[model samples]
Target: MKDVYLFSGFLGSGKTSMLTNVIKQLKERNLKPAVIMNELGKLPFDSQTVEEDIPLKEMLEGCICCSGSEKTEAQIQTLLLNEDFDVLIIETTGAAHPVEALDAVYSPLFADQLNIKGIVTVADSKLWLERESLTPQVRSLFLEQIRHAHLLLANKMDLLSESEQAKVIFEMQGINSHAFILQTTNGQVSYKLLENLQATSRISKDDIHSAKIGKHLHLSSLLIEFNKSYTQQQIEDWIKTLPSTVYRIKGYIPVEGVKNPMLFQYAYGLVQWLPEYIKMPAKVVLIGENVDEVKVIDE
Candidate 1:
């Protein structure tokens, strides 16, 4: 039976980064793996950043909860019929509800051929504290994602103080009394956590539409392409000028003195960088509401 792993999290929770690492681990074990990335908008940047060789199927313009269900079914059908893979990983958008994605996968047609290995949800420690500031519908959607997970990754733990981490863990346990909560930094998680897992979900398709209660988020993507190398201070200065409205920023940058290209990630006011030796173009994609494209470009 082909194992299916579903990853659900809020925006900028590091789902793509963690999923990429998981795929690498699977490849190391000689396990054929395929990826299905679901994005809320038609223009996607995460798909481009994933591993090049893994078979990837992109489900765009909607989350699997409502509009993407039919497409997801079709995509899964194609993967099962034409692709030779032992495991499949479906990375849902941050706005996605895990229950809906699960219902789409458990369709009658895919019953015998596929097995749900686990439902892993990445929780942003910084964002979790700010959940109360969100609209009622969005806040509820965020909690539902955590409540339904078999494994919850409390990511960005490095930024939290000891007391803050304890409180986040305490609240998470209260919300998801049964889930295995793991703390991680930059989404670096163990591959062994993905093995031999079981999902304890009792959610019905009818309850999954809770995602539609809120208005669709008004979001846009701004792609900035630059071939010139930047100094470390120059990169930091540029990131500091980014507006608060821009929630997510990720891409690669070539540094003047560094041999490897630097990977830049900014989410919820946290800025992180990692040196990547791989060949990649210098560019960044900014996703958020009311993004000032001109100002972002000028910076």
Candidate 2:
């Protein structure tokens, strides 16, 4: 059976990063995999970021809603027919509703060719708490994404306080208690996501135990692209102005201070600065949850 993994999460929840890491891990183990990413923005940065070329494709335009599914399935079938790989990963857009995205491929058209290996969801610790801000439609999608997954990666674990992290975990576990839960930073937990099918989901009755997503902050995530150079300290000091409610932040930022774009994280008053960019411009995304903060801060 071909393992088809769907990396589902709200926008900016480390889905693309995790998908890339999973591909790399598969390569190290001598397995070839194909990637299909749905991008909300104009750029195809995620497909380009994979370490070594294997077969990468992108479905860009809109979120993977039912309207877009028919068109996307045509692409997926093309990839499966043209490329021979052990696994296929579909990374959804930040605004995507996971259940709808799943329905797109899980349709009778493609379901026979792809075995549903797992649905791995990467959630930002900071953003997951502000579930209240989402419109009823999007919020329904968010919880449905969690409820349907076989695995849940509670990413950006480093951002939350111990108590806060525990509380979110308790809540998530309440959604799909049967799904295996793993905590990660910057989508680095490839081991937990791939090549491990320990068992099947328990299908507990509580998977749909409704919880109110009230009073949560509405978030607008932005991927800031820099055509000009920026100093490292400039970014450091700028991040200080962001509120503590920031759920998760990641991506490459080229520093005037250094050659590589430093990976930044602003959560729970902890800022993680990565070594340097191995590649292009300082592209970083800021996702503020339940934060009455700025829309997209650009340099």
Candidate 3:
């Protein structure tokens, strides 16, 4: 089983940078690592910032939950079989729910290929408190994700004053005493944390809040699938993913003539594309529940 680490954070919370730094540390040990980047430019602006490229694959503009769809486990199985890396790093979008991704991977299909090393949640210390309530319930979602993490990386502390950093740390740890909270700048968290850390103590079933349907936990995902064709440019211009009721949006986009499928991922207004391969069928899958999915799909 490979060590699978999930990096989740709120919009602009520096999740990408934190993930990149961790991958760098892994590479330094001469450990072959595989990275499954959710969206091209959603967080931390892609992997170009980090020099590790031997086994990098971008989901291109959409998240794993949205991009993988019916083929979710298949994609993961593919990653495990094809990539020679010892560790798999996944960077989720700011709007993504850690529970949803966890739910996806907990499936029996990936039973042999993967093991949950732990979850690392990155938070932008400077904006966390302020954005906690300003944007679409992101603060709540962000906190929930952190609550589930084995390691909580409080990133962008350099943007905060020393005292402010302390306060943020205090508030974060207060949520989950079990979480290994670390104050960091530019996502420079150490790999030792992962190596040295043991797995989380299994909580009594009641200890962890029961994930409810209407609650943050996703009982089901509503998909808006478009059978028609679309160009990469068209999908980029039309799609928007965020932290509102619409948690995240992404899917396979086929630019008619392009050989490879063009993926589209959007979160909190940070839109990114492959800007290279353009594929077809353009089957776009949008994941959202209740009224939000309707708003995007019915339109």
Candidate 4:
């Protein structure tokens, strides 16, 4: 039976980084790996991180747990039929609920061919500490992700002090006593550990069937395309004007003086700018609560 791992995390909690590390480790062990990446935006920005050689399927514009379930099953069936791989890793959209995602994967069409593993959630240590600052709906979603993880990663430990780290661990342990929690930086963890790990418990087929599948959160995404180059400072100024409801902003932006569009990412009020050697679409996807009403490009 093929092994499967589901990656769950909040936006910018470092799921993609962990995925990259896992893929590298899998290759090192001579295990073939395949990925199904789900994104809230129409553009598959995160899928670019997966190497061209790896078999990848992209599910965009919706969460796999709800509206995307049928597509999720179809993608899995396609991969299973056409690809030769030992393990499949599904990276759910940040807004996805753990239970619903598992339910979608438990489809009978391909259930017999797979050995289902547990959810591997990546939690932002700092975000957990400051979760109260988020909206009620978002806070609940974040905690649900942590509460359901079997192999939980308390990521971004470098940003926390000794005392803060202790608190983060204490809180995570309180929420999920069964998970094997790891304190990591840049989502780093040992693949050997993952190979031997199993989910604390499986959500039975009955539970999956009984569970509701619909809009799980108030979060939404708005895609913004840039027709003209803007300075980094201009972009930062616009970000400052955004309300606290805005959680994540990511995509390629055309910098005034740069030869190639730079990758811009904003999460939990922190901004990062990385230079991209190759030119990509000059657009940004904003994900947050009621983000569609947000104004853009005028700043």
Candidate 5:
């Protein structure tokens, strides 16, 4: 039976980071893995961050839970038919609701082909503490993501004090007593976290919290396509001056004097740039709420 794993979390909650580590561990055990990354933009950055040459499918400009349901089914079919993989990992966008995403996985079409392993949710400690500051719609979506998880991964533990981390775990348990809670730093966790996944059982919408009626989330993306290269100092200066509303900024940027394009990721005021060679065009995707596209372009 092919195992299907779902990684659900909020934006910048470290789901992608955790998935990378998990994929590496799975490979060491001789398991082939395929990935499906859902995004709200035309160009994707998280999928490009994955390591180890696994087959990847991008479901862009929509969440799989709602608008991308058909696309999700079709992609699963294509992967199952065209690829030889032992496990499949679906990383939903931060705004995704686990209830609806699981509904797509439990569809009758994939009942025989795919087995529901577990829904792992990654929560940012700092974000959780400041959730009240977020808009009601986004807050509800974030809560629902955590409420329906089978494994709640409390990521970014290093950023918090021991007592703070403990309190976060306590609060998560209050929200989801059934889910197994684990603390992680930089998305590193033991491979045992994926073990003993309850295969047959499925969670329904009613099983989740009493979320808002409709799946409404105010998310905007500033997609920028560029061909020219820039200096390292220029890029770093721009990142420092990013707007407070910007939730994520990722792109493939060519350096002025470097041979390869640099992969850029900035979120939660933390910045990362790694040099990598990709055949795809250089582009930047900025996701945030009520962000000014013109201002983003200026940066």
Candidate 6:
């Protein structure tokens, strides 16, 4: 049976970075790895991060826990039938609830063919500290992800001071005492640690059914396509004008005077722009509560 591992985290929690590291380590150990990446947007921005050699599948435009369950099953079946890999890694959308996502993977069609390892949840140290500021529904989803994790990563430790790190660790441990917690920078963790992890005994189909968790959160996404190039300052100024309800914004933006569009990521008021050599679509996907109603570009 092939081993299956799930990666769960909120937006901008460094899941893709962790997935990249895990894939590199797995390859070094002579183990073939396959990936299933879920994205809330139509464009597969994160899927591009996976290497070409690895067998990869993408489920887009929905969260795996809700609208994409059937599609996820089909993708898994396709990989199992055509790919030769020792392990399968599923990176769920940040908005996905862990238990529901797990339920989606437990399809009877191929349950016996795979060994479900567990979930590795990445928690942003700074976000955990300021979770109280989030809307109640969003905060609940954030905590639920950690609560169901078997191995939790307290990521972005480098951004915090020593005392802040201690506090974040304490809070995370307090919430999920059973999970093996690690302080990490850029989502780095030992592959051996991941290989040895066991699924949390608390996660069962019965619990998931009893909870009846659904995609009830008011969160929505908006895709913004740029018609013309804009200065970096103009984009940054517009981002600053956004309300706190916006959780994440990511995609490529056409920057004035730049040959290629830059990758932009904004999460919880923090903004980052990375230069990309290859030109990508000049579009951005904004994910948040009532995001569809928000005007993305200033007229």
Checking candidate 1 for backbone clashes, the offending pairs are none
Model 2: residues with Cα > 4 Å off, grouped in runs? 107-110, 133-137, 197-299
Cα lDDT tens digits, model 2, 1-299, are: 56777788877888877776777788888888887788877888777776556777777777765588776788788887898888777888867765456555543334435565556778777877888887888878788777766678888989889998898889999987767788789888755445564211111111212222222223223334454556766666667766664544555665674766666555457677777536644455444433323333334
- Tens-digit lDDT string for candidate 1 (115-190): 6766889999999988899899999998988887778899999999999999999999998876789999878778
Q: Write the per-residue lDDT of candidate 4 for residues 1-299, one digit (tens) a residue.
A: 88889999988999999999999999999999999999999999999999999999998887897568788989999999999999999999989988678656755345546766668999999999999999999999998898877689999999999999999999999988878899999999899778765431112221112222222223334445566788999889989988897766767888999998898878679999999998877766565544545656444
Question: Any runs in candidate 5 off by more than 4 Å, and if so which?
Answer: 202-299
lDDT of 5 at 83: 92
TM-score of each: 0.66, 0.61, 0.61, 0.67, 0.66, 0.67
Indicate the TM-score of model 1: 0.66
Worst 10 residues of 4 by lDDT: 200-209
Q: Cα deviation in Å at residue 173, candidate 5?
A: 0.8
Compose the digit string of candidate 3's lDDT tens values, residues 96-163: 77756744443333443455666688877877668645656766786787776768888887788878
In model 5, the number of clashes is 0
- How many residue pairs clash in each candidate at the backbone level? 0, 10, 7, 0, 0, 0
Model 6 TM: 0.67
Q: What is the C-alpha lDDT of each candidate?
A: 0.73, 0.65, 0.60, 0.80, 0.72, 0.79
Root-mean-square deviation per candidate: 18.8, 19.4, 12.4, 16.8, 17.4, 16.7
Candidate 3 accuracy as lDDT = 0.60
Clashing pairs in 3: 61-264, 61-265, 254-279, 254-280, 254-282, 255-279, 260-279
Per-residue lDDT tens digits for candidate 5, residues 24-88, read 89999999999999988898889887764788999888889755777898899898889999999
List the candidate 4 regions with Cα displacement exceeding 4 Å: 200-299
Tens-digit lDDT string for candidate 6 (1-299): 88899999998999999999999999999999999999989899999999999999988787787568778889999999999999999999989987568756755446556776778999999999899999999999999888878789999999999999999988888888878899999999999888776541111221111221222223334445565787899889888878787766767888999998898878669999999998776666555544545544452
List the candidate numbers ranked by lDDT, top first: 4, 6, 1, 5, 2, 3
